[model samples]
Target: MSFIESHLGDARQRRRLITGIRESLRELGLHLSLLNRQVSSRLELKDIDVDCLDLIDRHGPISPSALARSAGLHPATLTGILDRLERGGWVARERDPSDRRAVLVQALRTRNSELYGLYAGMSTSMNQICDGYSDAELQVIADFLTRSAQAGRAAADDLTSG
Candidate 1:
């Protein structure tokens, strides 16, 4: 039987498990978001701005439209965030070689290294928190999270389309 089906055999137990899962998901999301905001605020960036930075880091020299799409942000809003990053010397906009009309934004070399260092430190701390879990357990947790995120995205799409 499926994991969910197995866990949801009894109505009362299923209700309790579902409630606990929902509460944990909510608390984890809020805590992580708030923690990221606090850390980024110290570096003079808002949560959205930090997300923009992360997108750039993941896909360097990407177009503004592509960045906005990946970040789930509007093009106009992303333009504003890029403007701030540019002014802060964290990123640079260059003319796209293939398309003169399009601009490709990339993180500055020095800035990229600094950001990578910060990410490494944060990752280390996060990993430490899960160090008690066995590798198999972590893998299971990752799989569950991936499936949950996929479902959540589908639901969001349905809502928006409807």
Candidate 2:
């Protein structure tokens, strides 16, 4: 049985566990936001700028339209972020090889080491925490977190659309 399933003997216990999960997710989001803010400040960037750069790094050579969609910002706002990133040597705007008329934004390797260095401590801590979990347990945790992120994205979409 799963840890939660094994402990859920009654409806009250289940409700309490669910509430705990909800609260934990909220706390995690707040902590992550604060961590991003600290990292951005160290990089002399805004939190959203770092977030956009991360998206670009992960999805390059991606178009500005796609980056704007992923970042949930309007195209105009994304232009400003892209400009800053380009100026800081964090990213480059290049003509798409497949579509010469199109432009793609890609992360530059110049500051990538610095960015990774800032995240090394957190990466180490998370790896240590993951080491305690069995493969099956880790899979379940990953599935849950992935679903939670999807739910958050859907909820955000709903809010924005309405």
Candidate 3:
């Protein structure tokens, strides 16, 4: 039998690897959440604000309505959140040139760099570790991360749909 066929027959081996990956991903996610909370505390912001900030960082120059939809937040809640963020100088609302009726919320890039500084050591270490992988292996790792995030979002949607 080929190596692929042999591995396919070994369900226990696959299960072990899957279990290990799942547990590690869970722990890593918790640790990152804790780290984000730490940064939020240092910035005198709440966990929800940190979450919204991350969303803005990922999807900013984004409309508040779009952000609310992406984040599953109500308009009123998002308004209060955006107000605090703007008042704190963490974000800015700008006229959307394409849509005269809309204002886009954008991350204050320079202000965000201060938060990134808190994660510099972790970022450097992760980059060094990623560097150990070959190009193909890194591609596989990237694919796994992308799929994992998709799965996570789908699962969250499932849980909240009811």
Candidate 4:
């Protein structure tokens, strides 16, 4: 059975599990956002700059439209972020090889070692934490986090639409 499917809990059990998960996710988000803000400030960048640059690093050679959608920024806002990053030598905007009309943004990896180092400590700690979990347990954790993020996004969309 799939990870989620294997949890054949009753309704109350499921509800309790979901409540705990949501609380944990919220706390996690809050803590990470705080940390990110601190790091971004130290790097002399606005929070959105770090956010956009991180997105580009994760999905570089990525089209502006997709980045805008993923970042939840308006296209004009994304263009401004791209302009700032390009000017700072943090990112590069290039023409899409497959689509001349499209612009792709990529992180200038060599220019951002300090940014990467700032997260290394936390990443290492998380890796050590995960080392305590067995493969199946890790799979369950991964699946739960993934579903929780999707649910959170869906809820946010619902709120914005109404």
Candidate 5:
């Protein structure tokens, strides 16, 4: 092939690959939402409740206002979600020692193992998939996913702000 023709083919191939990646991401998001819904149903928890639990597990003991900001939930709605989580023994609201008048929400460690167990299958599957990639390839994939998530968050924030 001519040099210019070869370069044109490469450009077309790059566009196709980018399109495939975008579709794959969209499908992956739908599958993840399905998985989350299944796990939430198994635990007898609402989807939002499970989401709040994850945030708390990651960032607790966090104050309710901070949690609300992180979650993009209204404080009153978060209160109800917290109530359900507390009743389910998934989390607790306790006084912050550093500030007597404030309360912090924390995930209860007792139920953490159970939650982890529910996700163990996915972890194993992801590990098996990662086994096919070299470390450098895995790092690139991780970086891409992290950047994609950040971009999604930024886009969501823009939508909400407008």
Candidate 6:
């Protein structure tokens, strides 16, 4: 028999692989959606908003132009995000003490604490998920996934830049 026929000699093996792939895709989609919902519910922030917050928390206060560059978003898009965040009282835009022409976007103290707590909780849960894996297994998985992501990004870039 041919290699393909020998390996998938019966219909059952092919069916099982197809089913496994489908289930994995569904589970991944559901997991990401659920994680997004949980985070939004707990912190009253969307993914991009939280990303901006995290960036500010790490890099200190920054101007909207700098934030847009770092976040790979347009200045106009970042302005809208900043507007929503400012309106929610999570962040504020103030005139830069050193540069009167530039406004610095900063997180409010109370919201900063809230975001930190949520981050800590998520980190703990993620650590727990990897608890059962060996260091080598974790490294392999991480490497594989990183490569997969890079490949996907390259494909997208090709399509967009073409």
Q: Which stretches in model 5 have alpha-carbon errors above 4 Å? A: none
Could you tell me which 10 consecutive residues in candidate 5 have the lowest summed lDDT? 153-162
Better of 1 and 2 by lDDT: 2
The window of 10 residues in a row where model 2 has the poorest summed lDDT is 3-12
Candidates in descending lDDT order = 5, 2, 3, 4, 1, 6
Q: Give the better candidate number (3 or 5) by lDDT.
A: 5
Best by lDDT: 5
Q: What tens digits encode model 2's per-residue C-alpha lDDT throughout 1-162? A: 787766666767889999999999999899889988989999999899999999988888899999988888899999999999999999999999999999999999999899998889888999999999999999999999999999999998888678
TM-score of each: 0.77, 0.92, 0.89, 0.83, 0.95, 0.57
160, model 5: CA deviation in Å?
2.0
Clashing pairs in 1: none
In model 2, the Cα lDDT at residue 57 comes to 86
**Local accuracy of candidate 6 as per-residue lDDT tens digits, 1-162:** 998877776777889887996688679768866776677777777778877876776765888888886676789988888887888888888999998988998877876666567568667887898998999999997996788668756876676557
Q: Which residue ranges in model 1 land beyond 4 Å of their true spot?
A: 1-11, 112-122, 155-162
Residue 138 shift from truth in candidate 3, angstroms = 0.7
Model 2, residue 42: what's the lDDT? Answer: 96
Q: What is the per-residue lDDT of model 5 for residues 31-54, given as tens digits with 9 covering 90 to 100?
A: 999999999998999999999999
Task: Give the CA lDDT, 0 to 100, for residue 77 in model 6.
Answer: 85
Candidate 6 lDDT (Cα, whole model)? Answer: 0.78
* Cα RMSD to the true fold for all candidates: 4.5, 3.9, 2.9, 5.6, 1.1, 5.0
| CA shift of 156, model 2, Å | 1.3
Pairs of colliding residues, candidate 5? none
Give the candidate number with the greatest TM-score.
Answer: 5
Q: What lDDT does each candidate get?
A: 0.83, 0.92, 0.90, 0.86, 0.93, 0.78
Which residue pairs of candidate 4 clash?
A: none
The local lDDT score (0 to 100) that residue 155 gets in candidate 5 is: 86
User: Which residue runs does candidate 2 get wrong by more than 4 Å?
Assistant: 1-9
- Over 1-162, each residue of candidate 3 has an lDDT whose tens digit, in order, gives 999888887987889999999999999999999988888898888888888888999998899998887787888999999999999999999999998888999999778678889888889999999989999999999999999999988887787686
